[model samples]
Target: MSSLPADISLDTLTPEAVAKTIDHALLRPDMTVDEVVEGCRLCARYKTASVCVRPCDVRVAAGELKGTGVAVGTVIGFPHGSSPASVKVCEALAAIDDGAEELDMVLNIGRLKSGRTGEVRSEISQVVRAAKERLPGCCVKVILECSLLTDDEKVAACRAAEDAGADYVKTSTGFSSGGATLADLRLMRASTDPATTRVKASGGIRTLDYLVECLQAGADRIGASATAAIVDDLRARKASAPSA
Candidate 1:
């Protein structure tokens, strides 16, 4: 895993690993049920990371994807992580109530940027605690809106998430000004003592090349809106290449 000073080159990644890392996504508010159906179907076929959708559809998604390794995930503190910690926990409970198997929650970056370390950890811990208590065995991923933070602050956020018992520390909510970066992912990987926290890269990774770079930079999961194209590109390259 890459460590602090996250600036890795894209050349480090492999096409095979890239194919396994995408979280096939469709979180747009205006997304129709048909589009979601299409999205979910494609995700299942590709065997991508997860099929992230709105909180309301967790039960349906979980049901549709029964026995599939594909996970039913939803967002909390969503595009904005500035809400009261209790509110985000409640939202998590609601999503879980609907059959969510994994959670992708945005951390309170504003507080962390303001140097409120304890509060940041406290907020994350609340969600972690609630998830374990209520859902038991489900995964909780904390998104630390990387574009809004400094490198050191990014490291600190990862630590906080780990301390809070979060299963993963992720980058971006996709609503921020910028998205994932190799520098951030590498730094996050370095900050951990034991790799109890996996890294997730979300937002703006639209191409197969970008996704490859993210995986090489030590991101275990990727949240992308372009899963179809990325997978198709991989298949085309594979078919055209000489047989091994």
Candidate 2:
């Protein structure tokens, strides 16, 4: 994880900083083109890290976000990580073709739980290879779906991702039964080498307070549909703080 700036603190957080840490999510299945466009506009306006859209929406999102400094990212296996490795690789390449600069791919939860760590690692490596081969510097985040794993499983998953050359180890898919928790975040952070693989907190991070807490707990990036609410709340707090 990139170290937080030495001088920055939650009490002095800036809206821009907070926004940059967010991957404003637009992955809901029911969202239409118009809504996706609007969400892309919001992401550009907030200057978020990216707009994580469904794979099919990548083209539109990429077009809308072009030159806006917000990247277009998409999911691979999605809420579930059961797709065959070849299929996941195909999905990753297709998303890249559609202009996605980042890929969040789900790792096989069942395989991991069954002690198939080698297979899990190899699958992630294949996706990572495909992504970088298509577009150099493409970021790959491996979703562990931490809620479904025990502590040992989570650590093993993190190691697999790291060994596979993934850029980040993500906590959850948000569509899952549970979301990111402080304990999980801390464990994920501790499991990976911070200089190599960063941790992302997704799922149920709706408020500015909780977002900040995640940051403190070791989240380098956050995925949330509540981008506006969180950023607006930060702005409001900054506005109301007495001038130094």
Candidate 3:
């Protein structure tokens, strides 16, 4: 867990602080183009870190968020991590071309389960290369879907993502049986080189309490579809608090 102040209070939770930690998720399969556009507007209004949209919505999100200071991001290999290395690479490239500044790609769960760690690393490396090569500032996050892995497997996946040059190691794709957990976030943060890699917690985290717990667990970013409500709660609590 991060060394957050033991007595952290609502008074200290500014909108910018909350917003910077969020990656407004817009990845629901049934989400319409208009919804994605509106989501981008919300992201812009909140000054959130980015909008994590479906691959097909990257262009639209990028257009909607233009000059908003919030980045546009998309998923690669999506809820499944079985896509071929070449396919993942193409997906990364296309997303970049469509104006994505960040990519969250799922690692090959099957390969990792089968003990083909090298192949998993190779695939992550390919996508990382494609994203970084095309856009030097683009960041790639490898989703390990921690709910399905043993603690050891989770560690191994984090190491593999680091070796493959990923900017962050994320937990869950939200389509999985479980989402990010504090234990997983702590393990991921401890496993990686903090200077080079970060941790992102996603899935099943909708409330402000869960968001704070994830951050204290060392998560640098969060993926959530309930961005507006959470931040609104944060603001409301801060406003209702007695003056210090």
Candidate 4:
């Protein structure tokens, strides 16, 4: 993890601040509609940054979160990035039409590993273009699936995503062998220009301590299923703090 400045203190963090960093995940393949609705309610209660659901659940999530101050997001070419760019673009457009404000798209991992950086960048660009054209200010996050890549490939993937004009470069899909790591988060933060692209640490971030560490390591956002637990814990801690 990247070292924080000596003056920095996570102990002063607020629950609202922590809640805003989370993209409450509702992407489990077996999740029922009722569960998705409940998850959307959870997001609204906590005021999370977004609720990231499956493609088919975009409209459901959107309807539930409408006017709740929480955005609706969905994945494209999800766990696998083998789909053609055209397909990903179409999926992104449909997601936008369904009221999704954020699109987390998996870049073609195989192509990146195969040394086809141009192809990878091109595909990401296409999705970004299609999404932005459909909905201005729609955020796009490119998932790197870091556990499957070497440090070099991860760096290349970050650069490719940034070059393609993605808003964030995320760590994984949670279906992979591993999730976000402190080292990976630090490396990703270092690889991207902070002004244009931010880092999102996803996969296996189920606790507040680990989430704070990811933030210190330069993650601007978090993707997790434990949003309520994490935020509630932070709120409890703040409430219990001794009076100055």
RMSD to the hidden true structure, all candidates: 3.7, 1.0, 2.1, 2.6
Residue 44 shift from truth in candidate 2, angstroms:
0.6
Candidate 1 per-residue lDDT, tens place, 176-235, comes to 799999998899888865457788889899988788778778888899989878878876
lDDT of 4 at 218: 88
Write one digit per residue (lDDT tens) for candidate 2, span 120-231: 9999999999899999999999999998999999999999999999999999999989999999999999999988999999999999999988988999999999999999
lDDT of each: 0.82, 0.94, 0.91, 0.93
Reference-based TM-score of each model? 0.90, 0.98, 0.96, 0.96
lDDT of 4 at 126: 99
lDDT of 1 at 60: 70
Which pairs clash (backbone N, Cα, C closer than 3 Å) in model 1?
A: 3-190, 6-183
lDDT of 4 by residue, 1-244 (tens): 2123433345757788888889999999999999999999999999999999999999999899989999999999999889999999999999999999999999999999999999999999999999999999999999999999999999999999999999999999999899999999999999999889999999999999999888888888999999999998888887888988
Summed backbone clashes in each candidate are 2, 1, 0, 0
Error of 4 at 105 (Å): 0.4
Best by TM-score: 2
Clashing residue pairs in candidate 4 are none
What C-alpha root-mean-square deviation, in Å, does candidate 1 show against the real structure? Answer: 3.7
Q: Which 10 successive residues of model 2 have the least lDDT summed?
A: 1-10
